[model samples]
Target: MTRAFLLAATACLISQAAFAHAFLDRASPAVGSEVAGSPPALDLTYTEPVEPLFSTIQVTDASGGRVDQGTPKPLDGGHVLSVALKPLLPGVYTVEWHVTSVDTHKTEGHFTFTVKR
Candidate 1:
């Protein structure tokens, strides 16, 4: 009975690990970066495979308003999430993202960046 209980617990743990969603490993323009030129795009690298259909990235201006003109696209087989930015005035911007892994687990995170005139 004890052996069976141990096996069940181990199975549960393994299942949880397998269903874990990906997380941001790094972001291009590095969070809170200040740049003089307009960033062509925003890049977000994840810790694991992400589902493109359920993953999204948004950039908001310093006033807490969404400035991204369009939707984000997947890069490198859905490992990176990116979006283009319009001409932004010098200010701080926030990047908010929500990603769902192929395994069906979901994760969300946010970061900030700055643009200099």
Candidate 2:
């Protein structure tokens, strides 16, 4: 009985750990999407609440020029990060982000979107 209880507890802990990390749930422009016009801002949504003070995002043009206005700001209780953008011309933009979840887990990723003429 003790062994069975220990196994159940171990499984529960492992399952919880699997979801403890903050992962990118979705984003505006929808990762690798192409838009007809420039979006006013880039919005990133995560699976867990993140700490804005410990997060960063960068949007760069195809030529590798930074296009994001500045640092990111949190929204929806830190489940989302919004980054303002400069007026973007027709081109591909890369967004790179690194965020720390409220649980203190760090996650980072990058995606690209294109603006059609």
Candidate 3:
């Protein structure tokens, strides 16, 4: 029974390790951070390399109009995704992102940031 339990545990660990998802590791303006001024771009670093083609990032203001410009640009060897932003005025902004890791697993997340007056 002890030998069988150990074998099962090993299998479980290996199976979990075989799958990967690109989870947000960090950000430029950071999650829920307050900034003094507008950031030219939003930078998101993930736990694994993500595919640019399958990724989408949306930045919007409290009024719900999009502020982000263009497609996501892969940086830091695809682990970091950056998107340009239009000139922003001081207010609360939301960032919504979806990414597909090289393993083809899809992950998504959203956060908010404040630009101080």
Candidate 4:
């Protein structure tokens, strides 16, 4: 019984590792950059390929109000997501994302950036 339990625990750990979702590898306009002008668009790159249909990016203003008007688009590699931003006012903004990898595992995270007038 002890042997069986150990085997089960090992299997569980392996399964969890294998099904882990992709994490943010990098972003353009970066996580905390203060830019002089409005960024033409937002870019996010992940550690692994993500399911385009199951991924989303949401942009919000400093007051926590949603500011993005349209859906995000998947780049060719399937690991990058791009979203067009409206002409933003000088303020802080947060980008929240949720992505499900091709393996069907889900993960989510958020980051912030600021715009200068």
Whose lDDT is greatest here?
3
Q: Candidate 1 — worst ten consecutive residues by lDDT sum?
A: 62-71
lDDT (0 to 1) per candidate: 0.85, 0.94, 0.95, 0.88
lDDT per residue as tens, model 4, 8-51: 99999998896577889899779998989888788899888898
lDDT of 3 by residue, 1-117 (tens): 999999999999997875578899999999999999989999999998999999999999999999999999999899999999999899999999999999899999999999999
In candidate 3, where is summed lDDT lowest over 10 consecutive residues? 13-22
Which 10 residues in a row give candidate 4 its minimum summed lDDT?
67-76
Candidate 2's TM-score? 0.94
TM-scores of all candidate predictions against the true structure: 0.80, 0.94, 0.89, 0.80
Give the residue spans of candidate 1 off by over 4 A.
1-19
Q: Model 4 off-target regions past 4 Å?
A: 1-20
**Across residues 1-117, which tens digit of lDDT does each residue of candidate 1 receive?**
999999999999998896586988899879778888778789899888888888888898877787776777888888888888888888888999999988888999998888887
lDDT of 3: 0.95
Any runs in candidate 3 off by more than 4 Å, and if so which? 1-15
- At residue 56, give the lDDT of candidate 2: 94
**Top TM-score: which candidate number?**
2
lDDT of 2 by residue, 47-79 (tens): 999999999999999999999997898999889
